[model samples]
Target: MKASDQTLPLQNGETLDILFRSHPRARRLKLRYDSVRRAAVVTLPPGVSEKSGLDFARRNSDWLQEQQKAFAGQEFLSPDNFISFLGHDHLILHQPDDAGRVRREDGRIIVGGPAGGFEVRLLNWLKKQARIRLEQAVEEKTGLLGVTCHKIRIGDPGSRWGSCSSRKTLSFSWRLIMTPATVFDYVVAHEVAHLREMNHSPAFWREVDRLVDHATISRRWLRQHGPQLMALQICGKSPAD
Candidate 1:
């Protein structure tokens, strides 16, 4: 079946994939499911046909569903929500000041009112710190796992805690900062194992297990409270911040 022959109509709970062709700038594809819009988005590289794109989605159906479930449980942060940083609970504050800082003075991340808003700016700062901390942790743990990574970056990713690309770049969600240190370490180890083995094979599990003695607890924490962390608004930043 060729891509030009037919266009597939997406049904409820059914997945539809698309491929868009354009300029030769880069080989890239982006995935997002618009629940309100009621469709899955697949932005492909230039010169790609719709059929090949659909086939790609078919090939990755299981992965796509896993991503969708991850998205479903995510909670976007609101202003009234309280966020715990370091040790104390700070009500998300929205203020106007020359500087945006997420700091502890008298044991609270004072927001707005000369401090700053509690959303985008604060999230950006947290992402910056989380990347530094996570990359350090990844380097230390991967040494034990006996693997090297090309690069590491932290992002406001919606689907998963972390992902390892074929090129060896390790991308992690900045939301990991909300969790305890142990949980963060486990995620770092999990991604590093991908360097040794791309698939979730037994060898991969063994590598992760070797680095983090208690992996299941961290995994469970994300399964249960991960969405809650997603819902937190710090420094008036968006969830992706």
Candidate 2:
């Protein structure tokens, strides 16, 4: 283990992975679940004691267990299985050919490539689709909000669906393309609103509301279903696999 890392046992008999990270701007001990690494992280300010961080994590053990259980059952992406895209199920079908491309046809995503390279081809196609669609959505929302962004980029961040930087650049998770259209729109509107109000203040929400009327509903949906989206692995390796 690293110097900043340790393990604790949970009441449920599961090992709780803990990391003590120092944050330059952190004001207090913050414990959060890292879904990608499947660990609970405790971020502390420079002057905070390790005992304080451990106590904080212990206090939140129940919440951590619940989150771990939720993530343990996350759905994995695999070939020949159906996945939700734009609020509809799209069957994944693999076809062997020299051409390596993915296309949607009649409720199915047809992937053409050698069997060994199918995952890489499909992931590339998904990222490309995400970039094209998200860029378009950003353009439309920014136009409606009367704000201009420096640029838009796609990413696979662990804890956020989208973010807007102080430089006016916007970055979004490519996985948003797999969710419902309204959810994607809500995320885009959220970042676009950040262009005007960088914080989650009433004024920022007002801008989001102006762009999308169902912002609250979208937020709730993401909170409830977003984890399953994040759990999808392009390697086609499910927990059972």
Model 1 over residues 1-241: C-alpha lDDT tens digits?
1123332343337544443434354366544443322235555667775666666666666655654555555444444455655324555545456255555365445444343234555666667768878878987988897789999878766536899998999999887877778888888999999999887778989999989988999888776666556544433334542
Candidate 1, residue 198: lDDT: 85
What is candidate 2's CA lDDT for residue 10?
89
Alpha-carbon runs more than 4 Å astray in model 2 = 1-3, 6-9, 20-31, 42-59, 237-241
Candidate 1: list runs displaced more than 4 Å. 1-80, 84-89, 94-99, 105-107, 112-118, 231-241
Candidate maximizing TM-score: 2
lDDT of 2 by residue, 89-187 (tens): 999888877387789989999888788877777777888888999888888988988899999888787657999998999999888988899999999
Candidate 2: 10-residue stretch with minimal lDDT: 232-241
Candidate 2 differs from the real structure by a C-alpha RMSD in angstroms, to one decimal, of 3.7
